[model samples]
Target: MILLVVQTLNGFQLGMLLFLVAAGLTLVFGVMNFVNLAHGVQYMLGAYLGVTFAQMAGGFWAGLVLASLSAGLFGLALEWLIFRHLYGRSDLDQVLATFGVILTLNEGVRLIWGSAPLELAMPRLLSGSFALMEGLRYPVYRVAIAGLGLAVALLLAAGVHRTRAGMLIRAGASNRDMVSALGVDINRLFRLVFGIGAMLAGFAGVLAAPLISVEPGMGENVLILAFVVIVIGGIGSIRGAFAAAIIVGLVDTVGRGAITGLAHLMLTGPAAAKVGPALASMLIYLVMAAVLALRPAGLFPARA
Candidate 1:
């Protein structure tokens, strides 16, 4: 019971992280009608930036803010240098170009930071555990990560649903030609959306850095997960991203624990242990496939 509870929390925390990354990816996809295979690298860069800022400023909060800004600026720079040109290009071209960017960023990080995974220490203020119940305790930093992620989700929801800027974003995504016809500078909107997306991805990276090994190519797996999340949540829908991210996180985390336990019931220790993780990895994809089969537009698509 205790193990289940803890794993559930862990999974939820992971889901929040996934939300951060997926939010940006989905927005960019919906609004720009552009495929950015290099999006994962933005997350990677955020982790690296967090590491640099944390050490330089000698604090976690400083690091978080600086890392996010750096990541946003870096993304903006990419938008100007490469993505801007690819806006009207073919999907194949965008994919190829972004993929090239990914390759470049990956190698650049290796050259700059080396291939070893960087370690980030949790902020001193949050480096302890707190009681979740009478006897159950959870890491404070993990709780903080979830809290921060949720706060971001709420802010995003508010902005998208209530703000003029978000309205424009939605309008641009749903009907770019119409928005453009109305005198909206579609390019500027694209830039803002891309920058925000980059910042969100980076924010996720910064938060996860202390929890996971800070390394190159780390974004690749999470990027795939983010894609699954957006697909399940519905592209261009922040609400859907939030819901799907949490669902994916809980499902992935709990499935691993449940599968391992179940395998032990049917097989010997070694075989159960070996097969448990494999099945767990496939669980989310299975769910995604089922969701797609039933609703090709996702559970909450932003557009028809």
Candidate 2:
């Protein structure tokens, strides 16, 4: 019972993190009608930047703010230097170009930070564990991460649902051509969306740094997961992203334990141990497939 409770909390933490990364990616996809395969690298860069800036400023908060802003600016720069030209290009071209950017950035990260994984220092205030039950304890930092992520999610929801800019974002997502015809300066909107998305991805990275090893190509797997998130959530839908992200996180985390236990009931311990994880890893993809089969637009598809 205790293990289940702890893992559920862990699942929520994971879901929040996934929400942060997927939020930005979905926004960019929804508004720009562009494919950005390089988006995950922003998350990777955020972790690296957080580590560097935290050491330089001698504090975690300072590092988080600076890294997020830097990530946003970096994204804008990429938009101007490379992505702007590719906006009207074919999706294949965009994918190829962004894939190249991934290779270049990964190599650059290696050259600058080296290939070894780096760890971020947990903030002093969140450095201890708190009892969740009579015998179970949980890390304060993990709780903080989930709390912060949820706060961001709420703010993002409000911004998208209530703000004028958010209205434009939704409008753009629904029909960029129509939005442009209405004198919306679609390019500027695209830039804003892209920058914000990058910042959000970076923010996720900063939060995840202390919990995971910061390494080269770390974003690749995350990028794949983010894509899964957007697909299952529904492209161009923030609400979908949020709901799907949480569902994915909980399913993935809890399924691992449940599958293993079930396997133990039917197979040898060692075989169960081995097979459990393999099946667990497929749970999210299986869920995604199931969702797609039933509702091709996802659980909460964007309004067209």
**Tens digit of lDDT per residue, candidate 1, span 1-304?**
8788888889999999999999999999888888888888889999999999999999888999999999999999999999999989999999999989998899899999999999889999999998877777788999899999999999999999899989999887788899999999999999999999999999899999998998879989899999999999888878888999999999999987898788888889789888888888899999999999999888888886
The TM-score values for the models, in the order shown, are: 0.95, 0.96
Candidate 2 residue 135 Cα shift, in angstroms, is 6.1
User: Residue 176, candidate 1: how far off, in angstroms?
Assistant: 1.8
Q: List the residue pairs that clash in candidate 2.
A: none
Best by TM-score: 2
Cα lDDT, all candidates:
0.91, 0.91
Per-residue C-alpha lDDT of model 2 across residues 86-161, encoded as one tens digit per residue: 9898999999999999999989999999999998999999999989888777899999989998999999999999
